[model samples]
Target: MELDDLDWKILALLQEDGRMTFTELAKRVSLSAPATTERVRRLEAAGVITGYSATVDPQRVGLPIESIVRVRVRSLDTPRFRTNVLVLPQILGADHVTGDDCWLLRVVCRSMVELEQLVEEAQRYGDTTTSLVFSSHVRNRPVDISIFVGIVSR
Candidate 1:
């Protein structure tokens, strides 16, 4: 699992563009295609590279509105609340955080009415405070693994 400079370089390139071909990745990292492929396989085997996925624009797909919902629930209801949230298609992501709110959810909908309906459904499990997003300054950004790698390798 020890990653050298080449491994880090490979990871950085892949993070920037997961769809990059092995030949192109090899060219950038100064390795043969087969060697690069082997390195990537090793990284995957070590669980360093979990999976590859395509990034889609929710707005372009007709789900334009996004909202952040902070949910407060009784301790006994946490598990059931999470299970409910998982099955809800509007919920893009949910996290249990330390605060007045037991959970925070990123939800996307086509309209305000849809957003209201989603919130009402969530209210069955817990109380929710919803905030509509006007614009996102920073969406999903690639993680800078160098910091963690340096700390771990030291």
Candidate 2:
């Protein structure tokens, strides 16, 4: 999908507010509602627009403890570790990455004891290092289209 300026604008607007109506988006972009709708549809079909979701505050919702858990899994236990983590509700997100630690997880728990239990479970796979989050500078910022200007053009 070759995204022209209009498509980029639509993406920016939608990222800022996914709930924005097509008509409203059209007005801002100086295009007809149906045209804007079609462009959005194209973006979705091309896999650029994956899905819309509500951002929830973990602290407000009773899960106040947020931590980053890094796990260095034994090569033999990688599959088992992946399988086990899927059922853990405390794990908000996980990324398999390149480093001394094979897995980085965003975890939220109701209390420190719960986090300790989670760490113990993870230790079954391999060594674990966990750090509680004090603050977040950027939570969920919108994607800046300007960053991709040259690359997208090429």
Candidate 3:
């Protein structure tokens, strides 16, 4: 799992274009095709590269609305509310956090009505606050090789 600068460069490139062929990636990073392929394989083997996927515009795909819902569970004691949180399909990300709320969710909905419905359904478990995210400054970012190597060194 020890990755050098080259590995981080490959990862950063792949994060932007997962479908890049080994030849193309090799050209970008000045590695041989086999070397590029092997590096990608190693990253995959070490679980650094989990999988490849396409980045689609949600609005173009018909789901235009993107929002985050903050949930405050009444009974934060047990597993019942936790189960409910995972079963919701519109939810993209969910976290049990350290602040005031019990959970925060990143959700996408087709319309305001649908978003309202989802929030209402979520009320069975807790009170929810819906906020429409106008624009995302950064979605995901590449990891620093320095940080990765430091953590791996330990």
Candidate 4:
């Protein structure tokens, strides 16, 4: 979609706080509440706004250990690995990337034993390398629109 300045502003504000009401959003964007609602709906219809979700701290949820598991799966086992990985609750997210590793997974576990077991399960497919996350400098920062300012038409 060709988003204008107002649309970008709405996106920025929504990304900051998805729960913001249309009335407040309209006030911020200098538009009527109905207009703000219409724009938001249009953005949603166009698939620009996918969905809203809550950010939960793993530690508070009894899952403190965070690890990045890099798996280099054998060519024949890729499909099976992908299907099985989703069933593992410890895996928070996975990315199929380019490089020596076929899959990069973000996992959280209650204890080291669980993490070890997870790694061992992955090793059944192929080589595995796991690293515990000490700290995350940027967990889930809002997208910086400035980088796409010139690239995307206003």
- Per lDDT, the best of the predicted structures is 2
Question: In model 1, what is the error at residue 112, expressed in angstroms?
Answer: 1.4
| lDDT of every model, 2 decimals | 0.86, 0.91, 0.81, 0.90
TM-score of 2: 0.94
Q: Write the per-residue lDDT of candidate 1 for residues 92-119, one digit (tens) a residue.
A: 8888899899889999999999999988
- The candidate, 1 or 3, that scores higher on lDDT is 1
Off by over 4 Å in 2: 150-154
Candidate 3 regions with alpha-carbon error over 4 angstroms: 74-78, 144-154
Number of the predicted model whose TM-score against the real structure is largest = 2
- Quote each prediction's TM-score: 0.89, 0.94, 0.80, 0.93
Model 4 local distance difference test score: 0.90
Give the per-residue Cα lDDT of candidate 4 at 6: 85
- Give candidate 4 regions above 4 Å deviation: 150-154
Candidate 1: residue pairs that collide: none
Q: lDDT per residue, candidate 2, 1-154, as tens digits?
A: 7888888889988998999999999998899999999999999999999999999999999999999999999999998998886469999889899989999999999999999999999999999999999999997788888787553321
What is the alpha-carbon RMSD of candidate 1 to the true structure? Answer: 2.9
**In model 1, how many backbone clashes occur?**
0
